[model samples]
Target: MTKFIIALAYKLETSIKYKRFKEFTYNLLENNSYPYKKHFDTAMIFLVLSTIGILIFEVNHKNLRILNDYELFAVIIFVIEYIGRLWISSDMHKIILDDYEKYQLLNKKYKITKSIKKIISKKVDFILSPMAIVDLLAILPYYRPLRLLRILLIFRLFKILRYANSLKEFLQVFKERKFELFTLGLLYITVVFFSSTVIFLYEGPEGVNPNIVDFFDAVYWSIITISTVGYGDVTPITIEGKLVTLVLVVSSFLVIAFGTSIITTGLSDRMEIIKENRVQSETSKMQDFVIVCGFGMMGRYFCEELLSIGKKFIIIDNDKEIVNSAKSLNYLAIHSDATNMQTLEMMGINKGANSVVALTNDDAVNLSIVLSARAINENIKIISRVNNGNSRKKFDIAGVNQTIIFNDVAAFVASEYLGQPVAFEAIDGILLNKDFDVIIDEVEILDNSKILGKDINLVDFKNYNLTLLGIINLSNMNNFIFNPTNINYTVQKDDILIIIGFKASISQLKSDLINLDFRV
Candidate 1:
C-alpha cells in the first residue's frame, strides 16, 4: 500500500500542472523574496481583520447580513492556508525518492514503510507547530457555536501574527523566556491559592466575618489583593484576614519587579538577535563585505575610514554599548564575540567576506579572532592589531595577512594583501601623515566591467596618473602578475587591480571600468 502511494506521489510530482501549482503556492505563502508574497500577505491580513471586525459587530452592533459571505470566504481561505502550510512543510515525494536512491547506493533493500512513516511524521510535526496551531484555531471559529463564538474569534484575530513579522518577533521574545516566566508563575499560583484558601476559611459564612461568602468570593478577593487592586466589595475584617491581605500586598511588589526584569532581559536578547539577523541578511546580499571584529577606539576609527572610502563592512564587538554606538551611526554592527568560531561563521567569513580586521584591545582576543577566521576561510585576508610588539609573530603564525598597532596613528590600511606586493608602508604613511595627495587602493573587475574581454594594455593607466601595481586573479590566489607587460594579460572578471593614485582618480577609474568606455 505504501509502495503504491509513493508511486502515485512520484507521478503527481512529475506532472507539470501539479508542479507549477505547488511551486506558485509555495512561493506565495513561504518565499520571503518572492515579488508577489507581499500582496498575498496583505490580502490575508485584510481578510483576517475584516472577518474579525464582522464577528465583533455580530456580538454588539446591528446585523450586517451582507458581510456574512465575506466571513465565510475568509474561513475557507484560512482552511486553504492551513492545508497549504502542511503541504509545503515537507515534500513527501522527494523524501521517498531520496530514501529509495540512498538504499540503492547502500546496496540495501528500500524501506518503503520507513519512508511512509517519515512523511507522516513530517506532516504531524508541521501540524503540531505553533504557527500551524494558530492557523487551525483561526479556521475553527467557522465550525463553532454562537455562545462560543467570541472565544474562537479571538484566535482569528491572532491570525494576523502569521502575516506580521513584528508580532512574530514579539511572540518569540516571550517564547524564548518561557522557563523563567513559568518559574515566576509557579510562585504566583502558590501564593494566590494559599492566601485564597486561608481567607476563605477565616471569613466564610461560618466565621464571624461573613463578607467572604464562599470559595469563589475568596478567590476573587485573593486575586485583587495580590495585584494591589484593592476593592471595598471584599474587605477583610478579621485579624487573620488582615494579616493575609498584608502578605499578598507585599508579594505583589516582588512578583511585579521580577516579571519586569524578565521581560526587559527578553527584549534585550530579541533586539540583539534582530541586529545579528540584519547583518547576516546583508552579508548574503553583498559579496565582498569586510568583517571588522572589534569596535574599540581603534576599531571604530578603522570602520570610519572604511565608510569614508565607501567600503562595505560589518562590526563585531563583545561590548553591547559599543555595538549600540556603531548602530547609532547606521553601521552594520552585532554584539558578538569575534573569537568564537560560530560567531565568525554567522558573519559569513567562509562565504564571501573579503577580509577580517581584528582591532580589539586585548592581543589574545585579536589573535583568537585571526585563528577563527582563518580556520573558516584559509584564503580570506585577515589583519590583526598587535598592541604588544612581541605578539606580532603570534598573529603572523596564525595566518594573519598583516599586523598593525595604532598609537597616535588612528588606523592601518593593508596595501599588501595575501602576498600581492603593494607597499604597506607607503599607504600607511599616506594615511598617517595626511599630507600626501596620493593614495593606494584596489578595484575588483566585475563581470559587467567595460575592460573585461580586453587586453590589460588597452586602458592606459599612465593617462589617469595611476600606476598599475599588479592584478590578482581571485580564482588563482597564488598567482599575481606584477606589472604584467604581456600583451595577453587580459582584463577579466574577479581580477583585483592594485593601483596608486589620487582618491578622485581612483574613483573615476572605478566608474569608468563598469561603464562602456574605460579608455583613459
Candidate 2:
C-alpha cells in the first residue's frame, strides 16, 4: 500500500494540473494581489466578526435559531479555510518524490517511511505555527458538545491578523524582541512573587499591617505599589513591609525604563522595514507611474506638480533624510541607490513605469540613472537633469528622452526678459498659473474628433479663449509646427495641440473633443 501511495505521489508531482491547483490555492491564501483573495478575506472578516459579535450578544441575550444557523455556516467556512491553508502549507507529494529520486540516483531501494517522516515533519511545523494555532483555536468553539471550548470564540479576533498586514507588522516588533520581553516578564514575575510573599508574611490580617487581609490582598498591594498606583486602601503599615514596598517601587521604575527602551528601539527599526515594504507594495500596484530618482529641490517641485495633476509617482533617493522628509509628507519615497538597475526594476520599471526622471544634482549619477532605466525598460521615457554641459553627450548616447540644463534655461530666461519682457512675463504667468488666470495644457486629437482633417486656420481658437502655441505632429514628436496660422496643416488623429487657456476652457475643450462637439 505504501509503495502504491509513493507511486501515486510521484505521478502527482509531475502533473501540471496538480502543481497549478496547489499554486492557485497557496496564492489565494497568501498573495495580497490575487484577485479573489480580497473577497475571500473580506468574507472571512465579516464571518469572523459576525461569529464573535453573535457570541458577545448571546452573553446577555437569548440565542435565536437564525443566529445558530449563521454561527454554523460561519464555522463551516472556518473549517474550509483551515483545510485549504493546511493543504497548501506543504507539498507532501514533492517531499516523497524528492527522497525517491535521491534513492534512485544512489541505486538503493527507496524507503517510503523516510518520505512519510519528512512529510509529517513539514505538516507538523506548519500546524504548530502561531497563526495556525490561532486558526485551530478559532474552530474550537464550534464543537457544540464541548461547551468549555465555546469560550475560545475570542480567539476568532486573532484570526483577523491573517487578513490584516498592518497588524502583522505591529505584532512582528514584539516577536523580534520576544526574548528580551520574555526575560523581562520572568524578572517581573519573580519580583512580584517575592514581594507578594514578603508582604503576605510580614503584613497580613494576622500581623501589624492589618489592611492586607490575605495573600490575595498582599499580591494586590504588591502589584499596585510596583505599578505606582498606590490607592492608600492597602498600605504597608509594618516597617519590614514598607521597606519591601520601597524596593519593589524602585524595581518597577527600572523595569519600566528598560522595557520602554527595548520596545521603542525595536519599533523604530520595525517602522523603517514596514515603510519600505509599503513603498514596494504600493509601487507594484502602480501602472504608468512616473519615477522621480531624487528628492532634491527639482524633484520635490516635480513631485508637487505630478501630485497636483493627480498623476501617480514614486520617489527614490539615496539620502535618508530627504527620503524621510518626503515620507513625512505622505509621499511614496524609498531610500535607495537611483543608479542601481535593481532599484529601478524594483520601482516598477519592468512593469508599467511611464517615465523616469534623473533629477539628482550629479551628472554621473543622472547618466547612470538613464542607463539603468533604459536597460530595465527600453520604451520607458528617461528625463535627466544635466548639471554639467560636457555630460550632455553621455546622456544623449545613453538614450535619454529629454535633458534639462538648469543653468542654460535660467540664462536664456534672463536673456529673454531683456529681449521680450512682456511676452516672457505673459508666458511665465500662464506657466506658473499665479500671475494670470490661464494655464498651458495639451489636447490630443483622436480618431473620432470632429476637427480631424480640418485645416489649422479653420478651427476658431478664439472661441475657447485659447492661444494656439503649436501642434506636435503625431508622426514625429520633434516635428512641431510653430506659428501654424492659416496654413494647409490639416489636423490628424494623435496630433497634440499645445494651447494656453484657462483651466475650465482646457477641460471644456477636452470634453468637447471627446464628445466630438466642436461647435461655435
Using TM-score, give the best candidate's number.
2
lDDT of 2 by residue, 327-355 (tens): 89999999999899988887788886899
Which pairs clash in model 2? none
Supply the TM-score for candidate 1.
0.67
Evaluate residue 411 in candidate 2 and report its C-alpha lDDT on the 0 to 100 scale: 93
> Each model's C-alpha lDDT?
0.82, 0.86
Residue 158 of model 2, lDDT score: 92
How well does candidate 2 match the true structure in TM-score terms? Answer: 0.83
Per-residue C-alpha lDDT of model 1 across residues 1-520, encoded as one tens digit per residue: 7678768877987899988988999989976545577689899999988877787777777766678677788888888888888998888888888888799899998878898899999999998987788888788767866757557777876778777755777789788999999999999999889999999888885766667778988889988888888877889988998998988999989998999999999888787676576677676567788999889888888887788677999898999898889999999988888999998887778776899999988999998889888888889998988888877788889999988865423322332443443566555576656566677788889888888877888888888878888888877874788987454787778888888888888888999888866664
Query: TM-scores for all candidates?
Result: 0.67, 0.83
